[model samples]
Target chain A: MTSEPLVLGIETSCDETGVGIVRGGTLLADAVASSLDEHARFGGVVPEVASRAHLEAMVPALERASREAGVRLDDVDAVAVTSGPGLAGALLVGVASAKALALGLGKPLFGVNHLAAHVAVDTLEHGPLPQPCIALLVSGGHSSLLLVEDVTQTVTPLGATIDDAAGEAFDKVARLLGLPFPGGPYVDRAARTGDPAYVVFPRGLTSPRDLERHRFDFSFSGLKTAVARWVETREREGQPVPVDDVAAAFQEAVCDVLVRKALDACRTHGVNDLLIGGGVAANSRLRAMAEERCGAAGVRVRVPRPKLCTDNGAMVAALGAQMVARGRTPSGLDLLADSSMPVTVVAR
Target chain B: MLLLAFDTATPAVTVALHDGRSVLATSTIVDAMRHGELLAPGIATVLREAGADRSDLTGIAVGVGPGPFTGLRVGLVTARTLGHVLDIPVHGVCTLDVLAAAAEVDEGQVGSFLVATDARRKEVYWARYSDRRTRVDGPHVSRPAEVATPDVVVGRGATLYPDAFPNAAGPLDPSAADLARLVATGSVPVLEPVPLYLRRPDVAEPTARKSVLTAR
Candidate 1:
């Protein structure tokens, strides 16, 4: 390997087929193909549909990334792939692809964790991470709080959603509001013009008693039920539903609980740096709220650009480069895709 | 043409390395729920036993399935990825054809038989093939009782429902060697590596929008 290894990363953990090329800490190319439009009719991502889409898009995305990077496939020093905590069939496409690439090119392979990759991505936008930082990951499938001593090595999970993930909550609430699929952005847009104080939505897992037992853990199912019940009551009363207000109120509740717990974890753990990631981190309200709260707490906040926050191969590439630079051992040819791979195993 | 072939459409995971004429090495493991974990190691073991390396592969042949969604994609995606990286052509063969081609039949024998594999949900994915190994009919999914019985039946589906198929024959799962052989001899059409999901997916699109207002 050269002083700056050129690593190619493949991510098909969900509905997106992403390929990225990176040299050391610098990103050269990032290409993504999404099956969001196909899943829209279903109101959510269908695992089978997502898996089929990945098979169709993997080759094109790889070619596009390589072309955009201005590098040949043989020039890559290593191959990295997301191998877990995703839809089973979806994860297989990327893992299998990475294996083939590594075998064919005779390069080292790294099977990285999807969640830690989210935390590692911030390093690409902002320099190397400060040791022992806290990360809040909110996505369609997962929501968790992690303590990262080193993204390339160790990650400790502090808490996770007990029920629906943050993104899933948004999608369910958006459907109740008669909004389109992928409710995060639509809810954000609708919340922009409305009053956040319209209705007092429940803040789940934040009560004094709840905190004593599960401090950092989150629960959005109760909040989702609250929103659904409120809308149902309004309909039963023959009242025109205030869609914007409900959206604003719901968004407020989610952001409030998320920001509160994240900061709490940092304060309690005596860690000063905090990073927010995952698809839901792309929410404008969440970003602003996190920044504001962290600013007040004298804690530094790091969030990657919106594109990096969502599922992308650049994150995997970034993580892979760090592993290579640190002189970590590459995975054997028999690496497997662990559908329920925990966040602590950064690489396997 | 040197080739690597594998199939994960059934409980059995089969991997083989073959030259144009004969199979060098083959391994088949019957692991019900470990296809994702077992496939790569299986491939590596076969390559080692065959005294070959990954770089020696000239092509890849995969079993595209009318089988379970999760297990079927494992083989196809791996083949596609290997093909893309090696810059070689990849061929997709119908899994049922792999089993039919491996059947032992006399050269002059002229008859039609059924090749059925388990499709889960109390159904089987089956097709009809002549003694010459040409697909004569089917590639359909239906209940075992509903399918019209042929003179001879083969594959896991036959063993699954013995009463429906009294005349069952050799081999349950498709052999990886047969997949390579079929690709080498041009016995099956080389189609796009798209999966053959015989039935619709389990999930469905939303039928209508929920109303915000209820009748007073």
Candidate 2:
């Protein structure tokens, strides 16, 4: 019996150096090493810090992934790497490492898109994506709505954040509240017990006039500012800032608009499946709201397990395996990392 | 031992194949911005020219620079990955040392020589070598005028700042053939295959910046 092709994927688009191996849809391994603690003191991911960490972690992650998968490196049929829409310095580490690995192993290489990989990751958890699906990808770097025709070949951007991304706002607000660096989970944790209606936060780009131009685009900068101003007013009047209430209200505003527009996109496009991916997809509230609202609207929601939702090599490898299964051309050894790569070119 | 050597630390993306005793093939492209796009193909060209499969390589050598971090990391990461996959030992040769090693053959012999590369921001990454093999002083990043160097100079820093490095001579950057030869002959120190970044990353702790928080 001919077994499925074994593909290896590398992801160093951000602070994590992730290596994943997959055989068809089965996720054999997803090994990752993060430089999160190193960047914690900086309060943000310093590009240089991330690039340095990737170089240090790339080999170890690859070794661990292959070992965990119980496959020799030579058994891998193809190598895949995230080639763009990330920190240029950070992306180069992965791209260069992958190029060398593919060259050394005499295997085909696939330079896949980070955003599209987020959408394709769901296939590993659930199954092949329902064609003509709507993908809402929200992370520290991007908050975009996409229409995926074929995850490996075509993805159309509906809209993206004009200012701050969804997860970036979480970090900023968390910092304002004296929370830790990542702040997304901290804000999520704080919002759970707090009342969502305590202080009404302005929902961005939802106004009638704003909707005319940015119906699909998100605007979280305004919401982030409103939270700051509200906290400022409370302090000016000698009222202690209520952290829980603010976190809850702010989280509610962000999630409300995201779910509302995502479902709207699904409904308008006559699509039944809405897939949520990216770092913010790991948020419990975002997942719950997406599932609840999509279900109510007669739309199915698919989110990879929280572990697969965030950046990881398995997602890139999953997309790559699909590319191989579909008989797509492999990327050349000279493929450059496109820092602003559009989601349209799913693989290069 | 069959050796593969490559360097992206300099503007030139260079790759070479060596069969212990002599160089088999070499490739170099002098585009500073295209290191990531060029290095792998450069390696492929050299291996193909030498009729070598990557599995035939018994070792890998890389020029770890005091060069710009982005380009330098490309070579280091590639070299490290290639090493792991090929199950071969990878050596990090100081980029400056490689330049000096080549200069010795070009200029015959020198009591001492200096090697420098573009450090940008009006500075140079340089070192003073007692010969081709023994580095006496640096691997320092400083303004060209601030460095007191031996009159014999090699590397792009001399070409870029001839006034500060007045008596410029020899190859301006490392040659991969020279890097391969140096490693095959064991003429220089073989450090761990990590970049020799002589400076800290240019980022300040969050404490130095004003917080985005409103004044309370």
Candidate 3:
């Protein structure tokens, strides 16, 4: 309602029903209601369950966001929603709610890409992003390398996982170690006191042959299989598989490859800043390694706080705020919730 | 009372505007896969036709389906949000009841009949009614052959199972206009703004897998 765009963002790309309100570059409120407990019993996210939870959580989250921001819904200047690269049904719930809010309030709607939102969230913490930065986005469903010329306008796809995502690999390895579902945080916790040199795990896609074809691409499925084989051999030989040591070793491999490639991309693109964003960005080792590696290489690593790193509405709002500031055209009410929406189309 | 109603329980994305007295305008676009894309635009068109805006709405009504989960959630999510923004009352009407209401008025032919809609997986979502106003049994999901054969049947399931529903009649789908009428008249039971999914989400607890740790 004011001169600065007051944006409301809805994110149902996965198990979280997140609603965030942002006034210009400053974040106002971030209200998130996660259905992670529901999916935890299933070992992973179920699309139908997630969709239903989003519907149940949508209205409440919206109210909470506006209340926290101390602003009425009518005060919002525009609405933003994560419209892609997620579960089909889950994305639809958010896209539908956002459309309705935009329609009801007579405001513009911005259907944004989930990946681009992750990259743009960084700008909220660290003032405007330096153009032409390399971003390594890692999460449960995706492990993509992106070149960001602008968050609102242009983003070039560099590479992605050839098989399993880094978070998914962490989950699978955690299960093998008898840890809980969504073991990214738990693995990070257990690996702290354990020895990283306990076992030598293969770093995926780092070999010269692999680099020739997939210089920026990642592969964790083979490493996951290698970890499984090693544990099985240890158990079969009547030796107890040390859970902590295995966690540390596995975590080290994933972090090493991620930091190594990210710094390499920064060097290759002649970009001075390296940004890490997504669920995996919250990992202690990934953060430390990126900071350490980028510090050595002189390409500053920018990662938003852990809350913004994982999926949430603030990220989407951050991207939407950029779109409004840049005077980008709003998407029509017929904005499609494309499950595979590419990062190239930042705001659809 | 300006009431806006919609249903995405089936492939048809329907919207209607009611100005407390009669139906002002209504639209239905039957596209199976475009529920998310078509719903807001459909509502926008109906509002434009009625020469009104979404802020002019006083109440919201939506079909909480014993229908598909994905499409059904679209309507509920939209309806709830619109209600929230407008600070209006949202009435959740049973989708089958809306079809039954339409059958009683338009066709005026019914007594102890069944209303069934397509429930996918080769099944139908059906409920029996003593008349248009009172449901007698069902709102259950089953194969067509498993449903009680009534002399009269209404809704899309009738078109889907011709042999079983020989007397398939009334409306093929529930429109937003009829849903609006039901909510306005208080003719049917108002439900919580949640899905009426008769089936649970298809998932199971992870069975004990033969883990490598157990290899010893």
Model 1 residue runs over 4 Å out of place are: B105-110, B148-150, B207-216
lDDT of 1 by residue, A37-97 (tens): 9999889999888998998899899899999999998999999999887887899889888
* Distance from true location, Cα of B196 in model 2, Å: 0.6
For B28-133, candidate 3 gives per-residue lDDT tens digits of 9998889999999999999999999777889999999988888998999999988888888898988999888777433354457889999999899999887787
Predicted candidate 2 versus true structure: per-residue lDDT over B1-216, tens digit per residue: 899998888898999999999999999999989999999999999989999888888999999998999999999999999999999999999999999877733445556778889988898999988777889988899998898454778889998998887778779789999999999998898889889888888898765324335565
RMSD to truth, every model: 2.3, 1.9, 2.0
lDDT of 1 by residue, B135-175 (tens): 88878999999984846787899889888887787679888
Model 2 lDDT per residue over A185-253, tens place: 999999998899998899999989998999899999989888888877777679988788889999999
DockQ of each: 0.56, 0.67, 0.71
Ranking by DockQ: 3, 2, 1
TM-score of each: 0.95, 0.97, 0.97
Residue-pair clashes per candidate, as listed?
0, 0, 0
Task: Give the Cα error of residue A200 in candidate 3, in Å.
Answer: 1.0
lDDT of each: 0.88, 0.90, 0.90
Give the docking tier of candidate 3. medium
**What does the interface RMSD come to for each candidate?**
2.9, 2.4, 1.9
TM-score of 3: 0.97
